[model samples]
Target: MVDPRRAFALRDAFAQQVTRRLKVPAVEQRAYADRLQAALDGQTLGGLSGEYVVLVDRNANVQALFIYFRATPSDTWQMIGASPVSTGRPGEYDHFITPLGVFEHTPANMDFRSEGTQNDNHIRGYGQRDMRIFDFGWAQGQRGWGKGGISEMRLQMHATDPDWLEPVLGIRHSKGCVRIPASLNTFLDHYGILDAEYAALAESGKSLWVLKSNRQMTPWAGRYIVVVDSQRESRPAWAPAPGGKALAKVPAGASSAD
Candidate 1:
């Protein structure tokens, strides 16, 4: 077990860093760290193993998407990166809620990505061009999850419309998917976790990561997404000045599992 004092110090430092970069309030950062700790204690990743895991705290009220990286399965998870996101809103799309649970991100469902191009709506709904979509299959048993018309609820994590969605970020506004910052989406796509095979496939003019066998092994292949509910009811006043001011950007190609 990690030392309690070290953990608290790490959490405080992490909170300070997030506040400085994402402009989120100290309270919100702390709350997120706490929730992350709880999730780790519960072994929310199930039997999956990897150097990093994506954690979304619905309780933080879509304030940000937290990315944790560790040296190994036995090492403690640390806050390595983050991006502001908008989750499902209340009373929208049949009161569609972002389901909470452990999910695996597969390459099969990620072929269709957004290029930040404007739709007939004439708005950038899915971030800058070539932004990859990391799909985790269906959520809520494939209930109401589409954007406009009625369709199966396909829970996905991708970038959002900077002009419209970004402003309303850090809140419950998305139909069911987790809307993230554009740069973050690109970063995750360009350098996937446990994604060496996928990367190789892309290099050979093939852009797919379909799982063929359960015995396949990769050191960096956990790519797990764990969503947790908020413990608080309201947003902290100190969290980043809401309304999407374009938080600090985390440079791509900078990952440390250790």
Candidate 2:
């Protein structure tokens, strides 16, 4: 079994690292760590045994996306990776806030990967090639996220055009979907998250764009994404804007997207 104290410590350490780039307060950090520890202890995130789990903390105002791996149902969760993301912007009628709760990944929703291609405007909205799109499907919220209705918000997690979004990561800017880095998106796609089983089948196909779907569940088929945000009133003072110099120094493969 893993040490609870150690796990909490690691969470705190990660929060501190995030605070350096984003604007998260120490109090909010402690609260988030405690909440995650409690959830893990309670085993509230249900899925097949040993399934991978993703935890997204929006409270830090930095949009921290943490990935954990487990070998068994009772095994200690291991923090394998993390990334900075941009989530939905807060607004009414059209722009909506990212909803908070536990969501299950279903193959019925996640069936395609969007290649980062340019539109008529010469903008690659989806980042690098072969970026996976994990569609949670029809999350209930206000109308109009990124082209959907109130009852059927096509909520998804996808890669963003690095040139357009890398500078704005760790902040809320997306219409509703989660915008991530090309490297991070590729990592998740290559290893599989919600679409692991289908991905394996696609590997032997003629083209990734026209691959068949296998929707089978596996030990490593992760299908849960937990999103929680801080209730704090003020944003952290250290968080920088999109093009600030403080953010420019981040290394290519560091927590921030390259």
Which candidate wins on lDDT? 2
Q: What are the lDDT scores of the predictions, listed in order?
A: 0.56, 0.58
TM-scores, one per candidate: 0.66, 0.65
Record all residue pairs in model 2 with backbone atoms less than 3 Å apart, i.e. clashing: 59-230
Per-residue lDDT value at 233 in model 2: 62
lDDT tens digits by residue: candidate 2, 135-161: 788787544335654554567887766
* True lDDT of residue 71, candidate 1: 48
Candidate 2 — which residues are off by over 4 angstroms? 1-49, 72-76, 119-121, 143-150, 196-219, 233-241, 245-258
Best by TM-score: 1
